[model samples]
Target: MATKTAARASVESNRNDDDEPESIPAPGAKRHHFLDPRRATGRLFVATAVGIVATCFAPVHLDWRIRAVLGWDTGALCLLVLAWNILVRSCPNETQRRAGAEDPGRNLIWAVTVLASLFSLFAAVFVLRKVRAWTGFEGQLWTGLALLAVVLSWLVTHTLYTFRYAHLYYRGGRADGLDFPKDQKPADIDFAYFAFTIGMCFQVSDVVVSCTRVRRAVLVHSLISFVYNTTILSLALNVAFNLLGDG
Candidate 1:
């Protein structure tokens, strides 16, 4: 009887131990929230400034007149994208926060986009020479080819980023990286959705502009803008569509 009582006591003690709550980290020991809108905006501002300077200094064989016009366009587009990203970071929704946590997959897409832009630029330069040679440059096949290349390049870059954003949302629940807090109000969600749609419209405009340009510098600038704009727009549209459909 004593042995049985001892065994029962031991089992009871073990059960009690198992039922005890595990030690959680102290509140003070927990990491503080690292995300800050001001810092993100600062980074974006620096990036935009750097792009403007780089575009200004980037050597090209084009005429001074062409350079001035296209350089401004390029710089403006880069700045716009940087600002857009900053805005995204500043007011990130849950989907955005999740997407931000993932690898951006920028390398391959950037390379392809750059290559396509370069090709379009060269084609534009070549077209100028052709225009000088031929009386009517409107019906030339090369013009069509140049536009096609720019569009394709922009499309490829846009697609890569769109896929990455989708992956991030799937993994983290935000498209841009701002995770909606547990107690976030419905109005905040609606605002984020609206911002996303506006961002997407900017992207579509970029593509449209890139394909219509006839100058090398103009084409390149348009292509770059198109890539940025398309990615932002597509992601936003996808989220909006899904949310509406769910409702």
Candidate 2:
């Protein structure tokens, strides 16, 4: 009877082990359906496309207030989607955690990054063209709004990069690469701090990066920020010249 009980226990343990899911789910397996990263990326992409079209082709005579409202709403929506992607959808499905190379949403995020960069580029061009034809108080208001829009676009791009960094860190089991304070695993907000510091200062502030991929990401982010800041500076000079001419 004792031997039989021992055999039964062994069989139960084996059954439990067999019931456990894999550390990485195979491709095409059903995973988390809530706030799926792919779906979120698609939403952000469509919203950005709409914003770009509106900024480029909207009626030239549209009221400034209406344009401001639309721009603000669009910027806010893009930001919201990105934040959601970072907070809720940043992690891979349970089974994919060990399959580090199979991160499902990275490519989509890259597409968003490219499109976001275009949005800011178009915004800068729009401001440059629109400023040339207007002067005085109306000119100042348009210039201010245009600058704000460009800044907003820059913010969106950096925020997306923040999410990208977070995805990379966590996908690697939060093990190496970035060394956070107290040797703790970094969270989404920590990644934001890291990414924005690069955007603002064009260099890493406190965190130490030992991973090659993260360093590459930081390099790309800094380059983009530098370009964006230079564009804003040029816009400022253009606005100053236009206003002086009006005076």
lDDT of each: 0.39, 0.61
How would you encode candidate 1's per-residue C-alpha lDDT over 1-247 as one tens digit per residue?
9999999999986663333222232222222233322232333345346546755775576444334434434533453454345334443343334333433344544554565456445544444444434333442433344334344444434433443333323333322222334534222233334233333443222111111111222333345565655543343344335434444
- lDDT for 118 (candidate 2): 64
* Model 2 Cα shift for residue 243 (angstroms): 3.6
What local lDDT score does residue 160 receive in model 1, on the 0 to 100 scale? Answer: 36
The TM-score obtained by model 2 is 0.63
**In candidate 2, what are the lDDT values of residues 68-169, reduced to their tens digit?**
435654654666665555454443343134223234254665665666556555655666677778766877766676666666766766777765675455
Weakest lDDT window of 10 consecutive positions for candidate 2: 95-104
Alpha carbon deviation, residue 199, candidate 1 (Å):
7.6
What TM-score would each prediction reach against the true structure? 0.31, 0.63
